[model samples]
Target: MEDSRDPQFASLSVGDSAVAVLVDRATDDADVIHDIELMTCSEYSHLCLGMPSDDTGDLAMYTNNKEMHAEDRLALWPAFHRDRLAADGRRFADEGYDFVVQHQVGSRFVDYMNHVGESTFGTPMPESLSVVEKFANTATTSHYLVLHQALMERRIPRGSKILMVPAASGVVTGFLSATVSSLEV
Candidate 1:
């Protein structure tokens, strides 16, 4: 765009303009539970990785209990989702995007992006970690924060596509894929 945009949203989409959302965290439980940060950090991470075990039989026991909060199953969910993203990047490249966002998983999330880019596509990965560094994460909006950060800096390529990954407890995870439609925002 030829006009200036709000600095806070430079690297992110302007509502439905950039992002095409498929799902939202709207459910009947949303009306009843307002405070979701009810658990300790360790307990939260445990939802993704179940308690450790030494014996195969013990592990199987965990598997039987409603999937036992099965560590392997829970762990594989994220892996499978992330692994397929590289292929998504590849397929979307022809559309002028290089898969330039939404690789976060933790502090090492950026590292994972570069690693996957190298192993899967033989290219250097772009980082979106500055979103949290510049402006702290707001639960589900972290991905947008990074996107906006990139846009504010004019780091994102105009018309290029980007990806946003958001995860929640109860094993809920999501992805938002969008194209940069404006240089101003």
Candidate 2:
């Protein structure tokens, strides 16, 4: 898993689109990685779902449970609003990165990465949306598709730096940051 990035790409980010998170997993000794933050448990109400039946005998209502599961997914959104990612992206900009890599799950996430990139550099930046556009979503491997697209398009400039923000779930909510170079990846 420690292989270098794929192309002249800047970075790669992965994970679920929900659950706001703040994490910096970049290391100076290594190439920067493109990553993201996501959580398996979204709504606080998601925490309320599928509990082991209480000995008190409360039968789980199928419809109610489903509704709760669906409606309560944004419970963690407050933490990762556009402003937060904007702020973090700015911090990345300040760190001297030239571009960013992100997950391409769909248009919303694509637009989101654009928003964050725009807010970070105070200008338009290249997006990694082509992968999702062409291949739809590949779940955890979506970032790789993005990197592959970046390589094919030659969008990344050699020696440029990139940022990543990835997501994860399964009861865990966090992010990993890494700096990657286009020349190497």
Candidate 3:
């Protein structure tokens, strides 16, 4: 286990963005609830935070006026991109991030976002598509897990700029950009 008092860990909190400590289950042992991985993130310098201008009105569309169905919501996803995600793509470019880590709701969603991203940014946004395809599941930790996977694979070079757009229930979306530090896994 890493100590929060350590300089390396403490340094993560110096950035403008809020620090997050991600804990994920690392073992299958029935008696080992304590066996886990602790990821101390927030090493990057904050660049920007973005949210949709019209959340309440937009949320209704996602919920289909409070009558949301899984299939209906999935079908409506393509239209949803025209709103916040499209705007965020421009923001991603304006903020000068080297790459983007989109919310991995599904493989199809990621691919669709990439397609939309190409149109919005005039070039394909580099993202971890393979991670989403391989994982094949959605979790709140998807972005963090994807980042950790990329870092572990050395795919994201040190000091590279990164943008993350994560969406959630109630039709909320968030855009966070930062410069990567020399964080070790």
Candidate 4:
């Protein structure tokens, strides 16, 4: 399989809207592959075909996965979360993104992660927290849903730079950066 992080996979231009789909599990079963393709098409067909050509949005996506040494996933959450944020989170901030749509696994976890992010990035709490706080616990789809909510609410202005960090059980993390556009769902 091709690495989604490769520039060739995400060769987005200024006006392009990109979608990043990261599958942590790989299977050679034809049925499974068919199902995955069907799901992707069904879920994102609108974004792929309905977005206005004139909308000048910029999007970039990258995913990171740390090899697990411990059997218990929860045991490594804090360290993995903190370390990834310290590295990529700061880089994103330095690049001048408007805000991050952080994964809201839980209220306390989100707060803890935000504090860690602030300390690591040497910045105050981001305005994106409003979305996190509003929608308390969206498990796997926090990043995408939160971003959509923010865009729908007009909290993020057109052309604003945005970052989204979505993490999962395997310590899989994705960094998606996008520029807001006039395209509406």
Rank candidates, lDDT, best first.
3, 4, 2, 1
Please give the distance, in angstroms, between residue 53's alpha carbon in candidate 4 and its true position after superposition. 50
Residue 42, model 2, lDDT: 40
TM-score of each: 0.44, 0.46, 0.50, 0.48
Predictions ranked by TM-score, top down?
Answer: 3, 4, 2, 1
Q: What is the C-alpha lDDT profile of model 1 across 1-185, one tens digit per residue? A: 22322222222221223334343343443212111111122334433333333343222111122332344433433354445555565332233334545434344444454454444444444444445444443445556657666778777766566655444444454345555544345
Candidate No. with top TM-score: 3
Clashes of each: 9, 25, 0, 0
Instruction: Choose the strongest candidate by lDDT.
Output: 3
> Candidate 3 has what TM-score?
0.50
Give candidate 2 regions above 4 Å deviation. Answer: 1-90, 116-129, 168-177, 182-185
Least accurate stretch of 10 residues (summed lDDT) in model 4?
A: 31-40
Error of 3 at 172 (Å): 0.8
Question: Roughly what TM-score does model 2 have, to 2 decimal places?
Answer: 0.46
Q: Tens-digit lDDT track for model 3 on 1-185? A: 14532223222222323336544553433212211112212221121123322433321111221222133333333344334445555333444556677777567666665666666556557654246776744456667777778888888877677666664433444455556655557
The lowest-lDDT stretch of 10 consecutive residues in candidate 1 is: 30-39
Stretches of candidate 4 off by over 4 Å are 1-92, 129-136
